[model samples]
Target chain A: MTEAILKVEKLKKYYPIYGGVLHKTIGYVKAVDGVSFEVNQGETLALVGESGCGKSTTGRSILRLIEPTEGRIIFEGEDLVSLNDEQMRKRRRDLQIIFQDPFASLNPRHTVQRILEEPLIVHGIGDKNERKRKVVELLETVGLNKEQIKRYPHQFSGGQRQRIGIARALSVNPKLIVADEPVSALDVSIQSQVLNLMEDLQEKFGLTYIFISHDLSVVRHIASRVGVMYLGSLVELADKTELYDQPLHPYTQALLSAVPVPDPDFKRERIILSGDVPSPSNPPAGCKFHTRCRYKMDVCTKEVPDLVDVGNGHYIACHLHR
Target chain B: MDLDKAGENVEEDYVLEVDQLKTIFRTEDGDIPAVSGVSFSLKAGETLGIVGESGSGKSVTSLSIMGLIPKPQGRLSGSIRYKGKEIINLSEGEMREIRGNEISMIFQEPMTSLNPVFTIGNQMVEAVLLHMELSKKEAEQRAIEMLRQVGIPRAEEIMKEYPHQLSGGMRQRVMIAMAMSCNPSILIADEPTTALDVTIQAQILDLMRNLKKDFNTSILLITHDLGVVAEMCDRVIVMYAGKIVEESDVRTLFKNPNHPYTKGLIKSTPRLTSEKQRLYSIPGNVPSFKEMPKGCKFVPRCEYAKDICYKNEPELVYVGEDHKSSCWLNIEQAPSIEEDAS
Candidate 1:
């Protein structure tokens, strides 16, 4: 059996909404609520959802970037929630995150060399000479040349800047990298290049990735296993083939059908959901997707459905499945 | 310059015809050719898609046709005819009559394109008032009807609301409603649903399709998404470095693409139906305007580039029935490399 590198149990991140004169907490934006998943070593687990579905928040909460409100994040068999800030800082060497926008993430003023070496310096990995050498190695690994080390972030194109971002994330040699919409900002041609580089790196490093993106096509290309999220909850989780071919949940079925296929002759029977994703702050009780779900029943409005495995490690959370 | 009278009596073959159109921008660093000798035509009730990457000049081509390019730094050459009438060198006042009434454009970011401070009713009514010779009440009624036509529920309440009050999908629908409010002969949509999510994107695309069917509006779709192109467009134009490298019917463009850039773009896009072990990526970046190569614009990144490809740029030629591609391989000895190894 493959070793599980990171396991997230009932992860919940709620940002309090302030209201009235006294600034009393009226409610919480349930961005990520009761999200549970496990990442095996050297596998890409994609978390996909819409804009306010809490895919990004789940990724951030896994790295303790946003400080998840509840649930345990057990990494390498250690409970990260019990750890202090200083402990978490030291533990972060094994955990790194690559952001969506390459333009905004990197320090514009700093050179690529300085930007890369900062992680090594903060982690106390090696000396100046060794760190400098590692930066060049990181650049070469990500398909960039050593000559570009002195240049700033603005000097590179969108694809090259993304390469720089990847190199920075790889400077410390993290085991798990939470890539939050890594290639969404890039054009189609450049986006493929980055995706290939990421896959190659995963093979070379035996890395674990919690790939968070809204684009299902990209997710299908990179992920070994897929988890579908709806309004901060995991609606369905299955192997890539099983999920795409035979999705259990109605929302997953709709989302899968919604993707515009590239072939001109392919006419998919699309499930265009009416209305927008509801406000996360006041999300519907029981099933968050009931408002948009096509097969939503009366029981879906009253009782919350637990993510239970039916067969072949395929888990689903829906009243129909239950 | 009545809106109804424009393009009303013309029994022209093509609704819009662009011949050898070139747009150059003068910057601190010399004149950069944003669009170079590009030519295409839009027939009545046809959707022509211009597909390209960020700097492939697709948006610039659309903007040039719209007469939206800034006057001081940008210069336009060649011909743009609307229903057999020259419109390239028309005065600003003359262009204004045709801008929204004859043709309208919907931008990528609806939030930025829309006036945030003004109510939706005000913006829609103003657009209608500018083009159609209708009273305020009539215009307001027309705006609400247009909004309802685009599937906006509670149209009256939405009319009173501001731009920020609606979601991304709603905002794009508003932009579409405003653009179609004038019953334009041609609608130029530059990455209309690029900002929204996939589900919302599907909804907007469906709306656009239904609207196009109902009104028979000719659409000039400019986007980087191949899937969108495959679904919406009847004819597709693949642009690279300010030139049309390939032009064909949508089926031919996807099935048997002639240009290397077109092939690469089609292969690179991951399809939901099929699974590719590794996505085939083009090797290098798109060359900047200042650092453009001597011959083929895609030479640096192209795998099939030959010696002759570096010497002289190949002209866009008919490669198949209703298909055109610009590549030296079509004219000269083909490259030694086998195609579609992946």
Candidate 2:
């Protein structure tokens, strides 16, 4: 049996909403509420939902980029939440994150070589000469030329900048990489090239990925397992094929149906939800999706459905599936 | 509804006709040809989708048509015929009358498009009063009606609020309302939904479709997402390296894409039905404007490039009744319609 590399148990992150002249904490925005999932060794787990559904916050919390207000994160048998600041800094070498906008994440003043070498320097990987060589090697591994090392971030196109970002993420030789909407900003033709390069790098380095994106078609392409998040909670988690073919949660089904298929012959019955996603600071009571769900029952509005196992490693949080 | 009537008259009644429109930017280095010799016509009430990767001149073409391209640095050439008059050489005052009154545009980023200092009501009222010759009170009422028409709940309250107070989706709806306030003959949307969420994207697309029906407006929708083009457009124009590489009706373009670039684009996108282990990506990158190829721009990256393709540029040729492609490949030599399925 395969071993789980990262285990998150009921992780929660809530941002305080300050009000009044004294800036008192009035309420909390429950960004990530009681979310739990596991990523197997060298596997890709995709977290998908709408923009404010807390997918990005969940990814940030798992890496402790943002401190979780509650719950445990067990990585390689160590509770990351229990680590001190200095110890967590040291452990950061084993975990890294790649941001969505490559141009924003990378420093405009720094050269490509400097950007890639900073991670190695931070983790105390090698000396000057070794770091230089490692930077060139990393650039080559991400399908970039060695001569591009001297160029600034603005000199490269969006895709090349993203490749530089990927090289920077892999410089530490991290065990788990959280890529947050990495290729969504890129063009269609460039997107596939970057995705293929990512798959190749994953195989070469045995990297575990937590891919967070709103694009379901892209998630379907890369993820071995998929988790659907809605309004700060995991609605459904299952294998890629099972989730795409037989989605248990109504929200997941609606999301899948909403994606416009490429072919004209294949007609998709678009599930147009009437209203916008409710504010995360004041989510609806009970099931968060009950307000827009077509199959809402009386129990759905009154009771929160637990994430229950529904045969063959699938988990769903819906009263109908229960 | 009169499908035959609509189909037969589409070729004759074009609200806007752009012929060989070229826009070049005079950078410090040299003249960077952003848009080159692109031609297309938009019939009344038809949605034309202009699709391409970055730097493919899709947005540039739309901006040139709307006379929104910045001056001094950029130079516009060729004919942009709107209502049987060439708009490319129109003076600033004349173009100002055309802009927002006859032709309006919605940009990709709503936050930047909207003025931060003013309330939504103030902006909409100003727009309506500027073009419609309405009184301030009448304009305010019209602005409220526009807001309600765009599906913003509690129109009066929303109109009183500032742009920052609204969500991204609401802001986009406000933008649509402002653009539609004048009831322009042509609407140019340049990646309007690219910054929006998927569900919001669908809602906005549906709203635009409904508005097109109600207002009978011609739309020029520019985007890189093929999924949107497939769902929203009656016809599509595929651009590559500052040129229109292919143009066809939506069904024919998806069914039988002619140009190598178009084929590469469709193949690279990961669809819901695609079951391949890995996606088919186009090789290499889009050429920079300064270093464009001498012959066909797509030859360096095309899989079906031949010796003739690199030596000379190919003219846009008629491949079907309403389909055209700029490629050296002989479309007539290919198999029948049934065998050319994508």
Candidate 3:
């Protein structure tokens, strides 16, 4: 069995909502509430859900980009949560992130070379000449020509800009990459190109990926294991084949069914949830998805179901499953 | 689906017919042809989908039909017939009569399209009051009724709420409510669900389908998602570099896609059942206007490009019954199902 590269236990990130004249803390928006997962080495673990499911927040928290309110993020036997800012900064050399929007993420003023070299420079990896050569190598690794290195972010297409972003993330030779909706902003053709590129890069570098995306099809393509998050908690987690084929959780089933199949003749049993996802700030008790779940039970409203592995690593959190 | 067979009674047959429509924008760089000589017809109650990437000119075609293109900078040519009457060059005042009353449009970004300051009722009533003749109180009731029809909960309360008060799904439902309030025969929805999440997108698509059935409204859906097209559209037009590469029924387009670009698009989209293999991707990017190839616009990316493909472009020709593909291979001989480039 593959060894775990990162293990997150009861991870939580809550933003306090202020109210009253003195702006006292009224309530907490539980963005990521008690989420737990283990990402194995050289495997892609995809976290998928609708928007505001705290998938992005979880990815950020794991990287220490957003400080976790309470959790133990065990990375290489060391708790990342306990690390000081300076210590965390040093650890960043082995951890990287690729953002959703290539247009917004990349600095428009800086050339591709400068953007790629920035991480290397920050990590104090190599000297000027060596850094320059490394930048060219990184650009080539991400499928960009060396001549285009002098061009600004605006000069490249959406696909090429994402390549530059990947190149930047790879400059420091990170082991784990948290790519947050890496291909969502791209066109269909370009999206495939980038997805393929990412897959190729993963194999070449033997890297682990925490792919956070709302798109199910893209996740199905890239992920070895899949975790379906709802409200602020993981409702289901399993192997990609098991998750897609037989989703135990109601939210997972609904999410998979909601994805429109491309073939016109492909008839699918769609579980169209009645209303929008409930507000995360004041989410429903017990199962947060109880408001939208079709098979809502009495136990669902009063007691939160624990994410317990049914068998073969297929973990489900639902009253029905219990 | 055949325009010639529809005969002289074009108004009674097809709701909207766009013939050789061309829209070009005069930019600082040069004049870029956004939508060049694109032609298609929409029958009443029929959903025609235009699928393409970002700069593929799908949105431009819809804007041209709406007469929403800004003059001086953006020039529009060719003919846009609404119920057999040429309405392409109608004056702003003349076009206003047909804009919302006869044909209405819903944009991708509901937030940007909807005015934030005004309440939902204010916006809905304004659209109804503009093209429709009704009292303010009557329009308010109509707006609430429309909101209720689109599946918005607490319709009365929602009418009082601003655009910001609602979720992304709710905002989109409101947008549909506003678009349908006038009960336009032809509803032009440009990526209405693109900004939405998968679940919300499903909701919106379901709403659109229901609304179409209820109103028997002809829809012009402009989107890049083939999945959305398969779910919603009857006929699909595959656009690339401001030209229609293929046109067929949704089923045929998916089953037996004729154009190389069309095949590439379908294969490239990561499917739920797709094996964990390297996704087949088109070799190169869409050519810019300044650097468009002399022969085929897709020649730069086409693996099967021959000598002829680099010299002269192919016209949209019939490959099968109710199907058309613009490719040299289609003209040369029946295209063999070649394996995708590795």
Candidate 4:
């Protein structure tokens, strides 16, 4: 946990909304507005929030899959935002991303062999025979057998396709993998299998993951640290145990309480927030969560709170908290 | 003297009774038996939850009860008695009267369930008028009141709008409002909160719980999430491959789950409060009915399956007082459990 593999400072990705016929920029949709975090080596940092909260945009921004509006993405002590196309492409070898949909992410036409070998070929890592050997080895690492190499993506089930996705992410021996909702689309029984395979693979390869998901239980199980997002900003950041045990921020507390515990005998008081998440395009004044926050005060609707570290690296953004 | 009279002791107590219900879909390929001999009863104001993953026939069972299964595609058998009256053989007109008036259902996707072209007020008033002998003015007034009761702000303005004008949560609230306006004796909520996010899901679940208490209406809640079953249900039935594998009171099912599948399901779901090294996942895909095994459907994935388990299908037998499990292990140990209980 000492060495930081990735550091993001005030990262922002704002999509410009255009006006009528003239097509002029009317305003910007601050999708990922002023978000920041760091990932230590071999530790999973989970970004959790509902849809339209910019969690996916942040993940894509770090990978430079989506162009950022502002801020620095420092990977291995170098700012990634400043790198040119060639340099960024070279840097991409160490940075990879796995999408949420297994069915859509993989090319339908390509067999497992071709899909796995594409990364090695593009990176100029090995000869044809060596690349073929590496593809089979990658498949073995992700728990897929050699016989599946000849099959296409559609031929496999959701879990197996996810394994293929994981196998493809590991083909170039990348250090970091931005897994965005990897298991949410899978069935409950299959979700656990995929999660177990990921944990095992992470241990074997010393991989750092930025797991973005909405399910709190899955996040609590896998993440070393968690960042709670709301309306394109980090509301709270803490260790997984500390966050779940004593969440300081109102939004974090509400989110943790809202998630239903599986055990029928285990009854916890749930904080049911009224109404839905506000539109990210036209956010409310001051604290974005003020509309639904139970502990809302006058100052909450007047001034925006900064992310302040209370103690032991637990940071929260709320008016009630220091 | 009366053989059928033996099953009448508890029949009068329940608001709805479903016995030996099986629904088979006649596909082009072959007959796919989805819901096979499912039996359960819902008492007035009791929330009976049916939980299963996809293809477990949870939805089909609800559809069968509601008489919503499309004809020429489905074949339903067995008894569905509402207020001691069988509904399976009723005509379309009588069935429609019971469907919207006596029993209303809210499906998972509110966006698709509610008509797109109709205004929220228009459709809601239509449901009220069709069910009750209310005038247009009274029904419109009742619709607005129902919308407000479900916590939709600006109810008057919302009714004038369409379904697409509302968010997923708002649309669901409207659906609940429409369903509750009739105040049906039994409400079938089929994965009502699965489409929304967690925050909104919490809100909807709270609304359902409160509505059940205030109206004293029974609910046939069907969902895949075990957490939801724990939070909202009085009793639960865990289904697997078109059969009820386990049925018991909510607490007993969670604490002393006898079926291996039930145990695996509880273990596999990650607890939000604790950290587990790895989740215990059940292996193998749910076998399609086309190539289903002859014996127990869960035979391929049961960790405790013995030679006998693979030879014959286990019937749902009483393993404990007021609890049942369909597993050979439980059947073999039934006598021992009886001795222990005594």
Candidate 5:
């Protein structure tokens, strides 16, 4: 039940929308519109919503780092949107990422051993003292201390510069990372020590993540299949305890009853969803979350639903239990 | 709730007290302190909260209770008092006549805390003509009635619009209608919806619980969201690397959290109705006050430390009935709750 290792499919990215001073186009902002999922292998998926819901442009269009205009990411079985940027720069060394501002994603004049030895010197790997012992063993496996690898990223601390951006996305050993809001600019007691050092470096490197967040309680603590995203499509995916115990999308039960649960007599029934989100360059024409659906129907503003599954593996999209 | 039988008319039962305050900063690599001995009080439409994270001094104790710090480079000290008076060494013309009329903060980037070339009706009529005696057409009719009591919708065309013409939840409801246009009996706010959007942080926590039930006000609030302090505090405190490692009543600090850094910030957050598979996280790094350790600052990230919690400094005590905590393991939590209920 676990082979996938990234699939994606209907994808789409869009942008276009020009118009002001003779610059014509004027249309698309769809931003990852027909999104699809898969992930599997070592698990962790996530991708959540809200904030123009493209879920960080579907985690930078599965490492094409934004340039999707349409379908198929595939990975490990090719198709990273049909490669070629000289074979997607050798498939960007098994694609890595981890951004969300560890004080503006590091490099305040680089130092943590030249930012973990510039990704093992751009994946050339060993040549200078075995790239300074793999940049001091990726700064002691992201807990840092190879004598603070000559310090710099403004002398470390937004949880040691997100453990030097998770030791520069595990210096090229990355078999898929894409972490985006990696602990949303940290400090909730260092976001659980960088989500338990990204779940102990994905159980010591069998990796495959894609996390991208909007903090659904840090995606119910490091996902393992979640998805959701809205304006730019893919309405739901499942298992993280069946989408936090039975969500089946109404925007995942108003984003898991709009999060906020640090208990104080944990009450429930929230589902607020009133106004805002709309314009992904003029979105609404169909169930683009039927304008913040509280189960809206009447073919939710002229059709579009389609995600489907509804069984043990949960998938969703809408038309109230399709 | 009884912060030691106060006397000297501390404003007839606390409307903001503070006491052991502190602050510090004047650094040439020296006195950084940053709100060390912070005390509490609030009461009258209560709320309280604080919590911590990020050099835990909860925005320098709400900028030393809004005398907005920045003095001879931050150096504040004990008492703050407010209605009971002291106002931490007043005079910057008696603290700009108790700034925004007896306290009113609201920060966490309402886009650089507003003022992109004025016009939210000239900054809510220059804070209501610098603390009320009104007049530029009666402070533009009390800034269009605080931009229509903060729900802002054509409230006189959002007083000629500007803070980059709205939306980040309408510039945090025009910074909560310019900090409740001088309704200040203590508002402060700080991480006011940490740059929003969880459906506009549940519509700015339901517009700050309906402006604290229509301005009975007493807020304070600072953040680091323990779910916005269990949806708008009642009594909290917590902080860390700069003291008060726990104080209670937000349902007994979310049901019995007695400081091992408030049970590692309520078992390192991530809840949305619990599932866990490893995430308790409080292991090390937060000492900083140029490496302060040798005795509790969560003793090098605690796992219930032992040797007198690394040689001394515990004292917060009181457990339950206004549940305090500082922790030398709450003096063995009544023999570890009778050995975990036999």
Candidate 6:
């Protein structure tokens, strides 16, 4: 097998819930509870879930944007979580993140050229002339003309702003990119262009991506493998085809069914869950999806299901699947 | 499935008609023609979907019909007829009476649409009392009944709770209840379920479908998602750069899309059964209002643009008896199977 670019083993990111005037830690939020996955070079691994499912937290934790309480994050065979502040800062050059909202993530005051050149200057990659040339090259790579580089963030449309974000992420020449809902804020037509651009950039640069999104259709379009998260834990992980064709987890099945098919004649028997996702701080005792799972049994409410490897590289965490 | 034939009878049954409506926003940069000549009509008990990307004038059209477009920065010019009555020239008091009583709208974000300071009961009761000449006690009773109709449990207690106290789905349902409280003849829902999760979105769509049947209210659904439109709308209007590029029954619009933009949109969307190597994306970004191409707004991104497409805008031409699309290509002469395969 080819070497994995990034391997996460038993990662856990728990936020301490504080209360009272003293602000003492009362309980844990368990944002990312014992989740683990690998992203191969030149492949996209999509992490999908609804809001409050900790998918965003997992992406942030991988980049060390937010510190994880416990876990092992191996990047290029080096333990990222164990590294010190200075070491991690130095290592950040190899890892980057593209946030969800383009307007919010980019500085309105800075021009597109400045946004793309800041990473090179911080890393001391090159001098002013070299950095300027590199910024133009990056802009061209993302399908934007060099003349538009001097424009501010608000001057461009949402799709163009996201392209600037991608150009900035590529400026560092990172091996792995954790794009958290990169195109979710964009329009439907613009979403496809961005997805295609990301794919093309991956092929040209040999980059690995952990694409986090709530849209299943977009995830299925771009992802080689997919991981479904619930509350704070990964409920399902499998190849994209296998996961879409034959989802094993109850949550995964329900999620797939809930996605509206584009064809009007294609009538899908939608499995509508009765309630919203429970809060991470007060997740159900046993299975995270037991509160919403239609196939929940007595054991589902009492015992937490273990992620078991079914045949053909498919992994599922559910009592029914077991 | 035979909605193609039903489209021919739409003109006879339409309750609301908007003819060449234009809403221009006076931005600091220039007069941004947000919605240029948008025209479509809604039948009394039918659901008409207006779909487009961000800046494609989907929400602006709905806002123009509701007379809710903020003034000074905005100016609307075009005819809007409700039950054959012109709404563009209606007095403020006349529009006010028609707004909640004859027509109501649900915004994309329910959290922002609802007032946090007021209780759900207060909002619903206020809406009812404003339209109907009902007492406070009568309005509160009707509000509780409306809450229960929307699938909220303990309607009496929910009425007492503030907007922040309920979940996102519940708050949306409350918005729906408020919109329907006045029993408006036409309801405009603008991206009502876009902010919701998949499961909750399904529930909300199902709720809307059920409510439509129960109340017999016509719906003008505005959304960027074709899936929701497929599930809810009877007739679909595909918009781009402030113009309707395609209008057809939902089934025909999906089965045999004509316009290059519509075809690209349908193919670009990731479907549940789609197993393509890569999604077929249309090239180029949507042009700004000031920079709109003189000919076709979609010519820059369209795959089938010829020399003729660059000089003149294509009018909405009849494809089938009911299906219409705006494209320079003679769709009848083009390969039929190729369009279906997309």
What DockQ does each listed candidate score?
0.86, 0.70, 0.83, 0.81, 0.23, 0.72
- Fraction of true inter-chain Cα contacts (below 8 Å) kept per model? 0.84, 0.59, 0.82, 0.78, 0.65, 0.67
Descending-DockQ candidate ranking:
1, 3, 4, 6, 2, 5
Docking class of 3: high
| TM-score of the second chain for every model | 0.95, 0.96, 0.95, 0.94, 0.38, 0.95
State the displacement of the C-alpha of residue A300, model 4, in Å, after optimal TM-score superposition: 2.0
TM-score of each model, in listed order: 0.97, 0.96, 0.97, 0.95, 0.36, 0.95
| Candidate 1 clash pair list | none
Model 1 misplaced regions, further than 4 Å? B1-12, B333-342
DockQ (0 to 1) for model 3: 0.83
Model 5: clashing residue pairs? none
* Local accuracy of candidate 3 as per-residue lDDT tens digits, A108-211: 99999899999989999999999999999998999999999899999999999999999999999999999999999999999999999999999999989999
| lDDT of each residue in A69-136, candidate 2, tens digit only | 99999999999999999999999898999999999999999999999999888888999999999999
Residue B57 shift from truth in candidate 2, angstroms: 1.2
- Model 4 per-residue lDDT tens digits across residues A85-150: 899998899999988898999999999999999988889999999999999898888878899899
lDDT of each: 0.91, 0.90, 0.91, 0.90, 0.80, 0.88
Clash counts for all predictions: 0, 0, 0, 0, 0, 0
> Candidate 2, A33: how far from true, in Å?
1.1
Which is the leading candidate under DockQ?
A: 1
Docking class of 5: acceptable
Stretches off by above 4 angstroms in model 6 are: B1-11, B330-341
In model 3, which runs have C-alpha deviations exceeding 4 angstroms? B1-12, B334-342
What's model 5's overall lDDT? 0.80
Model 1's A-chain: what TM-score?
0.98
lDDT of 2: 0.90
Q: Report how far off residue A172 is in candidate 4 (Å).
A: 1.5
